[model samples]
Target chain A: MEKCKKNRKLIWLTIYNELSSEQKSQLEIHLQACSDCQSDYEEALRLRRALDEKIQVAPTAAQLEASRAELHQRLLLLSQPRLQKSWFDKVWQIVSLDFAPSWRFATAVALLTFGVLIGNFYSRKAATEYNFYQQQISELLESNISNIESVTYDPVTRQVAIELNTLNDFTIQGNIEKPEIQQLLAHSIVVRYQNLSIRKKIPESD
Target chain B: MGNEEELLIRRAQRGNLKAFEDLVKRYDEKIMRLIFNMVSDAEDTRDIYQEVFLKAYQSITNFRFASEFYTWLYRIAVNTCINFRKRKTIVQHDSLDSYLDGNNDNWQILNTSEIRNPEEQLINKELSEQIQKSIDRLPARQKSVFVLKHYHGYKLSEIAVIMNCSEGTVKNYMFRAVQKLKISLQGYQQL
Candidate 1:
């Protein structure tokens, strides 16, 4: 009849080692009337006492010392390898373990690399542009020298007299219209001097 | 309680190996017994015993005086047993029937009033071994609590500190363990 109860397992554990004095008296009174629960109580007590009396056997001293030595050796091995490593090596290992470069750190580094590349690209582009301008200035200076050396010019005022004093022939000429040539030569000198002044200013920008 | 042991512990925490070995010598027996009562294998007991002291040796520098040294050692023993239980796939082996020196050589008189005969004496020995098997069969936490409470005679509060649990939890584990042990050993009565 007691076996059909749902909480019988829990009840068995409850009465395994514990019962109040009143509960014990009550159980005793009930056991006197019932043979089944009496057998249950006796069996339970027997099991409990057997477990209580179970003794703990001690370890042999030899075995104890041997095991201790073996364990110490194992720990010593684990602690040994790192001792030979330099401080930098240890720091690197620790940093690698603890603060690995996550996606965020990688992204930051990648962005930094990208920025440096862009800056270098712009700097190289500016250097090439400056060089190109310098080459243009040198070509302009060479053109100015060819024009000045091919024409007869006054060395003091640095004027090009145009065809009026051509360096091709030095003989005196007759029947040449001198006044018209002088007007034309005067205008060519003014234009050539102005162009030379403008060409000279271009070198200052270099 | 010895001044020399106290001095050794202090020196061990300062990274002295000789002092650590001295501390190991002092508590090795007690720690071995504490582990033996759990696994009950001489070989495994020796293994766990070594691990406990080795752990103490390795971490001694970090040992603060937060608790008694013995308590700290006991905690290490319990933890090693628990970890051993986890790493081990299965702990059940054949019985110690062949191994026990059963020549009736060292049978001390156990409670002369209760013991009856050689047959009863044999039954007692078998019963003790059966109880040990039943204890090994317990869940790891329950077995640890029961061993600490029953064999080592630790207070529930003391066990709580070592186990890093509440006293109520320790007592509850002990209760459940005892109940389970009772049921498991009941099968032996038929033998």
Candidate 2:
């Protein structure tokens, strides 16, 4: 009787084939030994048979065919896009799961082309700027001054002179601490060093 | 699902309307039956049936094939029926007479068992009415569990997935549903 109470749940599960074989075998053994359980089992089977008999509620072929037609109409409407798809939905379709291999390939090629074009444009602009600066410096160094013959500091005159052999030999002499003189001397040396580096980067004409 | 059905589902997931329609034809009958047994009304069943497949169509893209398509589809059907019931006024458990008015074709005997006599036929009708009333009386969750378990013949574990409840909860529901029907039908015999 105590076991019968526990096995009652199994009665329905057994009727439905929801029990494992072990539990089924156990219930089978119990049903053989227990008359009350046997009646319960039989009753459950009768109930299932009756439910099975009465409740074959599946839409008949005609009914199903009708539902399918209606469902198709509704699905047609459902699959139809709104006047417009939400931008996010469009983007998600493109960038996410539904993004096609062809689209991905196109996207990749587009991006790579954009990157190359951007890189090419900026590099050419930068190279042009660098070349322009180089030309100006080389003109200052190679054309404006033939050579620096000497840079002299004279204590008696309290001045510094930078003598050059040029289109015409000239001297720029001023107080050594003068801002203009100090700046010019610094600028010439810096430009000359930069011109040397830029020269190395330029390909030598064959 | 067989490989062919899986192909159909993949196509459907990608928004193939024809493929989705094929899936609908394949599964809608069972879904309609589940709905009919659930709501016990043809119009309501049709509405829920439409809602179920429509929702499946709308949301098929989200289906990751994490589970079988039928289980996922059943979840949609069960929830749609439950929600449709909740949205309408609760018609307290009562006569299925009016509900059965236009639903004659929904009833089919499993074996087409020939009736011996009118008396037996009357008893069978009474038994059928009683069974429907018993179903109508169960709470929504319990009724879903009951339908999925007994009518749909899903194992408790599968029902657990469909119901989105624990297996133990499904078991308890099945037990209660059985007990209710057993009590309700006790007065009738051999119908």
Candidate 3:
């Protein structure tokens, strides 16, 4: 067979009646010229005949009727509302990916839910950070002097001495709601800004 | 398909049970036979028959007028047959002499009832069984190609369309199947 390898396909195609008349003629000429191809062609014919001689069977009329009847019953059942569920159907419904579209929809829903959750977390964090900055800004706008290091209240004198955290150590002693106490705080803020401006000016001078 | 059959399919797609049943009646026998030929078991064939049509029903709405309706249906039927199991029986080894070697082997004897001569009857009956086994032993592609060609009388080109392969591939499958059958049947009866 390997001796006439090209004709192997041609032999089968001819046996199967798939070749055109021109192709059949071409194969015939090759077969006539090549003894190996001739033998192959003859062998292929014998095999085709052997198969043709075999008996063939199909479903019986009775079997067909039973199948059709069964199908009809199933179709009728499909039409009617089902009162009960089989355990397998219930299980399959739960477990089945329910095909591609539903699985994709579930994934989309999950990703959206996840996105909402992440958004919620970051927004809450942003709100907390905003509140923290608001407190700092309010403190700055109101009294300006911050980072009160320590306080000592002298009960007999009715005086509060607050030590301020600044570039230089400083203390203010006054009644809590007194105008003098407010003046000290304002003065401290002015000195702090003055120092900040001087620091910026130094950088430019350098 | 005729106009009426086409119309019936359209109605079936729209969920008309009567139209569907009418359509089923037209092709059910042939479909069942094709399934039976592939599986070679009545019981398995029936189960496949129901599954094929049920699948067709479930997916019919998606069936646009793509090819011939039977081609579409055969695609479903053949795919079900292929997926159902490649070869139901363990492929028999090269040839046993005794015709009734295994009665349990579900090889159907066809057209043997009409044989009057006892000796010829035996050969014919046994030869059919042997041939069927020879066919079953082929690889799935080769088996399907031979079955669709030999049993169903499908042109190789048509089979390519049905099997979703090129005609050249179908012919190659046919050649390989014949070669396998030739080797398998050689040990037993000539046919």
Candidate 4:
């Protein structure tokens, strides 16, 4: 004889099925020897019969229709588009800075990286250009002031030259030829003209 | 109802509204009855039954022919009933007096001939009712297993899928449910 282990659960399930002829014989042999399994099987059939009676019950047809209608309406309501958001959705959107679909996430990351790179490059170029312009302006101003201080011999030329420097480099150009120097030059020219007048006595060549 | 249910599920999954409506017409009663058995409240059972079907409708798109349509529907019904019961704190208990009175009265009407009194019928009904009470007293999971298995004729594997449990777990539940019911129906043969 094969070792027929009595699996209690297998016996319980077998009670409900159309047992094979051999399985029926086996069950009979087992039941004849095992009172516990037999009683369990009998109780299961009794409980099933009771449940079947309960299932035979019917409700009013109108109530059934009403339930269907009500549920249909409820489902429709749920299906309708309404502004529903998760409570934390906005907060997450603000704080996350990384929420997107897979493709969109990748695109957004690429765009952000591109933006940062462009911004950094432009800012560095602008700073370098600004420093260069400051150096050029300072050099121009220094050269204009030095030119004014060094001008001396021709007074009329000096005025015209100073005027040109002031017009071109007004920021640092200033008056450097002194008034006393102008007056001395004017007086020396006058004395020379007077000595020539005394030597020739009849001065007019009218 | 069975064939029509199968056909409607097939056609509904294919996007046939008329077929789905016909299916609803066919099963509307049984669906309500099953929910009523689980929940016991008229309003709640009715609502749950409708919601179960609506869910079935919406989820028909995801449904595959892995199991019988009614099996899938039964899963929806059972889950909806369980959720409804949990949310509303509703529990079903055995109606002992109603069971006894209803059975005795029906028998009295059927057995018009006093000479042929079928006393065994009454005893059988009582025995079955006591067993039902024992099933009722079992924990919710065990009771559902007992109902799905013994009443609905669901296979263990089907029950496992519907209940979302391992087959071994379903077997364990059925085993314990049967053991408790057998003890509760003690002296049933003498009844």
- Candidate 3, residues A84-188, lDDT tens digits: the string is 978987667645545477576786677689899999999999788656645543554455354556556555565666676555555555665555555554555
Worst 10 residues of 2 chain A by lDDT: A196-205
For residue B180, what is the lDDT in candidate 1?
A: 81
lDDT, candidate 4, A1-206, per-residue tens: 12233535556667667346787777778877777777756666665544444323345555666676776676566556688778698656644654556656776677689899999999999788656645644554444321232222333334311211333543222222544334322333353222322121222233
lDDT of 2 by residue, B74-108 (tens): 99999988888889896543244432344556444
Q: Output candidate 2 Cα RMSD.
A: 14.0
Tens-place lDDT per residue, model 2, A32-127, is 999999999998888777776552444667777787888888888777877977999987875554656768878767768989999999999978
Error of 2 at B12 (Å): 1.6
- Name the runs in model 3 displaced over 4 angstroms: A1-3, A81-206, B86-116, B189-191
TM-scores of chain B alone in all candidate structures, in the order given: 0.83, 0.86, 0.83, 0.68
Better of 3 and 4 by DockQ: 3
lDDT of 1 by residue, A66-88 (tens): 66677667756755645476899
* DockQ values of all predictions: 0.23, 0.34, 0.34, 0.17
lDDT, each prediction: 0.63, 0.76, 0.73, 0.60
Please give the C-alpha DockQ score of model 2: 0.34
TM-score of each candidate structure, all chains considered together: 0.54, 0.62, 0.62, 0.52
TM-score computed on alpha carbons, candidate 1: 0.54
lDDT of 1 by residue, B107-170 (tens): 2122344646768757876887778878888988889888877677676777888888996787
